[model samples]
Target: MKVACTEKSQILGSKVAKTLGLPLVYSQFKAFPDGELYLKTGALDGETLLVSSTADNQSLVQLLLMIDACDRSEITLVLPYMGYARQDKRFNDGEPISSRAVARALSAGVSRVITINIHEPSVLSHFRAPAIDITLAPEMARWVASLGCDEPIILAPDKGAVIFASEIAKHGGWEYDHLSKTRLSGEEVRIAPSSVDAKGRDIVITDDIISTGGTLATAAGMLKDGGARSVHAACVHGVFASGGFARLAAAGLASIAASDTIESAASSYTAAGMIAEAMRE
Candidate 1:
């Protein structure tokens, strides 16, 4: 079977296809000045995997169109980073759960789906197919340990991220703590460390997603202020929407690393092999 990728997702998808011994299928993508997207592929294949990360609006749109192109064959969708997942629930009465809109568009032509550490698995309910959700904390922990940095400490940006931090800590055989968050508003928050002294320690603030990055940046600042010698980040999906990357960098993160779950600059490494292994089963 041949494999292909949506415009933006080609980068990471190519890596996965290469690892799985599949040829990279190419398609043309461009838009008219009037806002219509044009898409085409050379020939039809029996089955095709359409890989794309919904990191932003353009990717989301391209994924929908590509699914239509695969009408002749079965389509398996791989979205390492799924956007709008955190908004699965409506915070207010009139607010729409954008995840449903995204899920509906995605499930339209796809036969199955796979994602890594989705913000919420309940969002899978939006898809009408066999879905698999996985994580990359195992690889991340191994990498962190190999780094052999000075006195290490694992910290979760907030209580919601504690589970991910815990996994990494378990993998590295280290200790961890969570930062409590009081969401003041959609864009404002207050954070407090639940335990542990980070002073002069190598603080690794970890999380699944980093959209806007307000939470991670704040925690990083606090860690430094509280006497932590350094701050680093290892996120599963670097969803740096709204220029959150610059903000996080400015917040004093020494080195930021992210798995290739999203098409971003920090995806120096990947866990696609693990993802494919799960799909193979």
Candidate 2:
């Protein structure tokens, strides 16, 4: 099978193709004056590996178009960063589950689906095809290991992400904890490492997605104020919506990085190796 990709995931798709020693199909993308998306991929007949990161509406539509373009090929879809996954639940009446909607749309004509650190694993149930999710904790562990920090602490922003943090910490036998909050008053709250003092310790706050920098940025300041030597941030998808990275930097975070799931200046690591390994098996 040959590898193909939407425009947004060209770099990552290329890496995965190279790792697996598969021929990468060339593609051309265009936009008309009326804002219609256009794409054409090299001839594909049998099996195909289609990689795409649907980070926004345009990318999502492009993915649908690319899938349709491979009508005769059996496609294995890879969504490295799936948008709208956090909206797995419908809170109000007359509201649709956005995650389910997107999943159903993409599942059409696909043989199987693979995702990386999807915000909610439960969302997989909405897909029409067999779906599997992968994590980048191993990659995160390796990246932090190269930082040469003294037994750095791996911290999840909240309890919800503790499992992911634990996975990363175990790789190096490092300490792991979740940020705990205490209410001093209606106007003031305190956040710090739970069950452990962060004093003079290097801390890495990690999560699956970093959409807005509000929480992490706020926690960074408090972690430093709590006497932590330094604070850093890492994640699987760095959506970094609206000055997220700048906010983290302004909060005094020593560094901020993410996987190439969504190519950006801060994508200091890669998910290609893991994707290739999974595909090989």
Candidate 3:
């Protein structure tokens, strides 16, 4: 089997292909004057590992096109970052479950699906094909270790992320805790470690996604104000929307990094190794 990718995931697709000791399928992409997408693949074998991060509408359409292009081949689809996954539920009466829509649409042509830290695992069941999700906690932990932090404590910005934080912290036997909010007064509020002392300790905030970085940025400043020596941020998907990275840096984050799942300036790590292993298994 050969490896192929949509336009947006070329860098990560290449890395996965190399790690798996497979050839990278040459693909050319362009946009027509009317704003339609175009793509041409060199060649595809009977089985293909197709890597694509649907980070936007165009990328999603492109992935469908690529799957059709590999019509004769069995495809193992990899979605490093699923764009519409956050809309997993329909809150209003007339609303559609967008995650289900996208999943069913994409599952039509692929034999199996793989996702990295997907926003909602339930969406996987929406796919007609067998689907699985993988974690980048080990990669994130390694990246945190490379930071040379002084006994840094891994922190989850909220309770929902405590499990992920613990996974990262266990790699280095670091203490882990979730941030807690307290109402100091009618107009005052405070955010700090739930049970651990942040004073004189380095901290790393970890999560699956960092969309606007608003919560993390605010937490970073608060942690610093609470006497934490340093605060950093890390995640599996760095969806730094609306100048999120800049916001985190400006909020006094000592450092910020994320996995290549979303391919941004802050992608200090890659999920290729994990992906390759999953494919082999």
Candidate 4:
């Protein structure tokens, strides 16, 4: 009945603690002047939940430590955001599958795993333990509705994001569609819908993760070009690396929001309630 979490995921840990009616463990961690980490926490059980996020490389290391410390009991790791999943495959002869490395590290520590909106689901097989993937569809829909956007239209950045966008639209009783993506280069791409009229729709563009904001910005640009009145962006994990959000806004995105998977500045949502509910089964 104990709960623990990494620093990047404190935002999610807070909500999960509230929903589960449990207290968060007293864990103290600090970084040395040279940037080394020091951590200490109270006693724990085998039946514990470790809430974590993929905000940075450190969070992953912290999670591994927490899992090892909880050897006295079984552990369930809840990662609101999963990084490295995009590198699930070795596209080149000398390329390393970072996603598999991450999964292996995590599996060695915890007994089971949980995550939301992984960029590549196949990465789950890299883990030695069982893993579950959750979505923020119901939660995202509720928030968009709360924003008072009447019958919103959920737009996917690309085909990969259609499943998430469709679920959001389904929950909100809205319509959804995926824009097309044409990669111009390894780092450059273009996006536009094949056929859709979005002249006056309140569009909410969504995806699994927002890494460099290239896909989203490109997609939003196309929607607006096609007469979309307004374009907002949402995602389960907002990496926003190298000023991705700034780029998205510069490309004319109305707003940028994400769940507190990483310690990003735009984490306007939490998945604790959703995760707790899903775990009840």
Q: List the residue pairs that clash in candidate 3.
A: none
Residues 1-281, model 4: lDDT tens digits: 78888877776787788899887887887888998777787789747888888667787778777777788878888878777788988899999999898888888757788878777888888888998788788878877777777677888877767888888888867888888766899997657654566777778888877879976787788778878878898888888888998999899987889887776679788788888987788
- Expressed as tens digits, the lDDT of each residue in 21-123 for candidate 1 is 8878889999999988888875655888777887778878888888888888898888888878888989999999999878877898788998888889899
Off by over 4 Å in 1: 181-192
Q: Which is superior by lDDT, 1 or 3?
A: 3
The candidate, 1 or 3, that scores higher on TM-score is 3
| Candidate 4: pairs in clash | 46-73, 46-74
Tens digit of lDDT per residue, candidate 3, span 85-187? 9999999999999999999999987999999999889999999999999999899999889989899999998998899999999999999999999999999
How far off is residue 174 in model 2, in Å? 0.6
Clash pairs detected, candidate 2: none
User: What is the C-alpha local distance difference test score of each model?
Assistant: 0.81, 0.95, 0.92, 0.81
28-71, model 2: which lDDT tens digit per residue? 99998999999999999899999999998889999999999998
Candidate 4 achieves a global lDDT of 0.81
For model 2 the TM-score comes to 0.99
Q: Which portions of model 3 show Cα errors greater than 4 Å? A: none
